[model samples]
Target: SQQGEEDPQALSIQEGENATMNCSYKTSINNLQWYRQNSGRGLVHLILIRSNEREKHSGRLRVTLDTSKKSSSLLITASRAADTASYFCATSGPGYSTLTFGKGTMLLVSP
Candidate 1:
């Protein structure tokens, strides 16, 4: 499958702590992205790193890509209770316009 599967299907952590999620994809990709889905809203794009980029950070979020390993990781630091949601990783293949998404990782942050 072109889609990746996130590790630790679910995670629970306290506010002010950090949460990390890993994703593994099967095929080559042009870019990989991290997204957050809340209960009622549409998916929110978190970060997208190209195959050439090794690491990227936005606010409290950090993402790393290893093209050689076909793997990527997302790290959320100083997380808050509002951060509780399902996170997904999406990848676009070299010549494909559509993106394949992973099952997702559920993160629960308690106050």
Candidate 2:
């Protein structure tokens, strides 16, 4: 099973600041996605970038994928205390429906 690794295991920022996290994977994939999880809850899909796509955006979130480097990055602009959560990147391999998730980056936003 292929898995992704997220950098800066933890992050802390003030409200209205921006938060960025990176994910690196080992295998070829069809699509890569980012998800956010609040404490003690399930994950909510944030955005997805295909192997052929270099960048994508959703609301205040920005996602970039570099298939050549087998890596992706997620950015959240104007972060809020409500945005404090763990962010994870998941990748689905070719012909595989299962997605393997990264360790996750915990973001803390101060009010």
Candidate 3:
């Protein structure tokens, strides 16, 4: 499968805590992106890191990529109850316009 694989399939945390998710891919990719979906609905783009980038951050989210290991990680700081959602990592490989997404990591944040 072209899809990536995410670790720690599910997580539960209290509000204001940090949550981390990891993903690993089998093949080379041009870029890696993280997304969040609420209630099994559409996904919302969170951040994108290029193959050449080691780390990228936006708001309370931080992402790291290690091409040598074909792995990536997403971290959310000071998570809130609203942060409860499923996160996914997706990658676009060479010569492929569509992105293959990982299964997902379900996060539950309690207030």
lDDT of 2 by residue, 1-111 (tens): 539999889999999999999999998999999999999999999898989899999999999999889899999999999999999999998985799988899999999
Worst 10 residues of 1 by lDDT: 1-10
Please report, in order, the local distance difference test score of every candidate based on alpha carbons: 0.94, 0.93, 0.94
Residue 42's lDDT within candidate 1 is: 93
Per-residue lDDT, model 3, residue 111, is: 99
lDDT at 35, model 2: 92
Model 2 worst lDDT window (10 residues): 1-10
| TM-score per model over all chains | 0.96, 0.96, 0.96
Which consecutive 10 residues in model 3 have the weakest lDDT in total? Answer: 92-101
Listed per model in order, the count of residue pairs whose N, CA or C atoms clash below 3 Å is 0, 0, 0
Per-residue lDDT of candidate 1, residues 3-111 (tens digit): 8889879999999999999999988899999999998889999999999999999999999999899999999999999999999999998875689999999999999
